[model samples]
Target: MTGTANRSVERAFRIVDELAENGGGRVSELADRLEMPVSTVHNYLQALVETGYVTVEDKEYSTTTRFLEVGHRQRHRLEVFQAVSDELQDIAAETGEHVTLLVEESDQCVIVAVQEGPDAVNLFAYPGARMPLHAAAPGKAILAHMPEDRVQGIIDRQGLVEMTNRTITDPDALFEQLAEIREQGYAIDEGERIAGMVCISAPVLDKSDEIRGAICVCGPQSRIDEKRRDEIADIVKRSANVTQVNLDYV
Candidate 1:
C-alpha cells in the first residue's frame, strides 16, 4: 500500500526465488543462501504454504502450481502475445526450426510463446525464459525499434553481459548493429546467445509504429548457413508482419 518497498515482502520474495532456482531447500539452507535469518525464512515459508503458493514436505520447502496457474492466466491476457502466438507454428513449419514470440520486459527479453518444428533442438528458450537483449536476435530486433533513451536505460540497467564468445559486448558495436537492423528490418544472431546456434528475428509494430514485440526463428548453424540465412530471414519477417496486422483486430 506504500510507495516504498516493504523489507519483509522483499525477503519473502527472495526466499521464493531461492526455492524456485534450486527446486527446493530446507529452511536453514534457504536462509544461508539468501543471507536471511532461519526463523525469518521459516515464517515466510509457512505463510506461503498457507496461501497455496508454496508447499512443505519433510521440512523441505518448494514452489507450488499456483505460479504456473498465475503465469498462464496473465500470458493469455496479453493482446500482442495472442496475436503473435498464432503465427509461431506456421513460421516453425516453414523454417523447420524453433520459433518464438518475445517481448522486452524489465530490460530483458522474455519469451511468451514458442513452437518447435520436426528438426527443432531443445534450447534454453521457453515460455517465461529471460535473456539479455544484446545476446540474441529477437532482443536486438525489439531494441532497434525502441527510443534511444530507452535503449540506453536498458543498457545501463542490464549492461552488455556476454553469453558466449560471439556475443556483442561492446556498446558501440551493438549500437551499430541495431542501426543496421533498423535499416534491414531484421536482426541476426550467429552463435551469439548460444554456440553453434543461429537466429533470425523481425520487429513487430503497432499502428502507431511503436514496437509490440519480435518474432524469431532459430536453429543449428549447420542447417541455417549463410546461403539459407536470407530465406529464413524473409520467412521470419513475413510472419512478424502478419502478426503486426493481426494486432489491430485483436
Candidate 2:
C-alpha cells in the first residue's frame, strides 16, 4: 500500500472511533478532536457515509447499525465465547455478582462480555473496554499463566501504572503476587484498580493449554470479606474450569 493510502485508512478509523466516542458529531467536532482539518474529516465522513458505515442528519454524523451487525457476525464465529455463555449467565444469576470474561488484546485485557449482578452497583465494564493487565483481577489471572519472559515483555511495554492507592506499583511485589496467583490458580484484586472494589478471577485455558482468557467476579469490599473471598474465588475457579472443558469439546 502507498503511504498516502495507509494514512487515509488511519485517518478514517480515527474519525470512526471519535464519532463513536462523541455519539454523534459534526465534521468540525471530529476534526478538532482528531487534531485534523475539517476538510479531511468531512471527506472521510462522506466516504464512510457512502459505504453505508455512517449516517448523517442535520449536519451531525454517527455510525450506522452496520457496525453492530458486523460485530454480531464476528461473535458468532468465536466458539470460545459461545462455550462459556450459559455458564457465565448461570454464575451471575446464582451469585448475584458481576461476571466478566476478558481476553488479552495488545498487551491489555479487553472485556468481551459482562453479566451484571442483581445488585444495583456494578463494575463499569463494556465490550472492548481495555484495562491494564497489571491492575485488574481478570488481567492478572491471564498474566499469571503467561511465561515469565512474555509477562516481563508486557510489563516493560505497559509499565505498572497505579490506578488506586492499593494498586501494586513495585515490579518486584507485582511479580511476587503473580507467583502466588499461579500457585493458587486464581487472582484477587484488593481494591487495587477501583476503590472499595474487589475482584476474583481464574484463567480459562484452551484445549491446547493456552491461556485464552479469564472469568471474573466483581464485588464490593464488604461483600468479599476474607470469609467470602475464598468462596468467591472457588466459584470463579470452577466456572473457568467449566468453560475450559466446554471449549475443549467444542
Candidate 3:
C-alpha cells in the first residue's frame, strides 16, 4: 500500500463530512457543495450507504450513528479522560457552570468530556469538538505547561487566528500571559473565543509533570465577574489538581 493518503478514502470522508455538516443533501446538492461531479458524488454516496455508514431519506443523504461508536470507544481509551470522568459532575455541581475536559491533539484542544450544571449556559461545545489551542482557557492552560519549543511549533502551524475581538493575536502578549498562567497555576479566558463568556482552567499533569489535559469551568460575564472569577479559579484549580492526583495513581 502507498504511504501517501488514498484519494478515494479522502474523497469518501469528505462526502461524509459534508453530509454531516449540512445535516443532509441530495446527490446534486452534494456535488455542487463538494465541487465534485454528480456521477462521482453518487458513487461515493452509494458506497457509504451500502457500508451502513450513511442513510438516505427522500433522496437526501445523511450520516449514520456509526461515528458515535468509534468516537465513544476512542474517548474511553484515553487514560486522562478515564481519570477525570468520575469527578467532573461534582465540579459542575459545585460551580453551577459548564465543565469541560480537553486534551491536546494535533496542536489543538479536543473536548472529551463535558458536564453541564444547573445554571449552565447552552453552548455549542460538545464531546469530540476541536478548537485552536490558544482560543480558550483550557487550551491556554494546556499550552502554558508545554515546552517552549513545542508551544512555538503549534503557533507556527496554527497561526493565532483571532476568534473574537478580544482574542490574543500577538505572540509576545500570549507568551506573557502563559507565563502568568504558569505562576498562577491556572488560566482565564475573557470572551477570547466567545463574547460574554468567561472561563477558568487549570492543567492536569501526570506523575512525570507532563501535561495530560486541562479542566475548565465557564459561565457568562454577568455571573463570572472579577471577584467570582477568582473564586471559580480556585475551584477549577482544586478540581484539576484532584484529577491530576488521580491520574498519577493510575
Candidates' lDDT values, in order? Answer: 0.90, 0.87, 0.91
lDDT of 2 at 123: 61
Model 1, 1-250: lDDT tens per residue? 5534487778788888899999999999998988888888888899999999999899988999899999889889888888875588887787789998998888989999989998999986778999999899999999999988899888998899989999999989989999999999999999999999999999999989999889989999999878799999898888888888889999
| lDDT by residue (tens digit), candidate 3, 1-250 | 4544487888999999999899989999999999999999999999999999999999989999889888999998898988885678998999899999999999999999999999999898899999888989999999999999999999999999899999999999999999999999999999999999998999998888999999989999999988998898888888888888888666
Candidate number that wins on TM-score, 1 or 2: 1
Clashing pairs in 2: none
Best by TM-score: 1
Candidate 2 has what TM-score? 0.94
Top of the candidates by lDDT:
3
TM-score (C-alpha, index-matched) for candidate 3: 0.96
Could you estimate the TM-score for every candidate? 0.97, 0.94, 0.96
The candidate with the higher TM-score, 1 or 3, is 1
lDDT, residue 159, candidate 3: 94
Question: Model 3, which residues run further than 4 Å from truth?
Answer: 1-5
Model 2 segments more than 4 A misplaced = none
lDDT of 1: 0.90
Q: Which scores better on lDDT, 1 or 3?
A: 3
Model 3: weakest 10-residue lDDT segment is 1-10
* Count of clashing pairs, candidate 2: 0
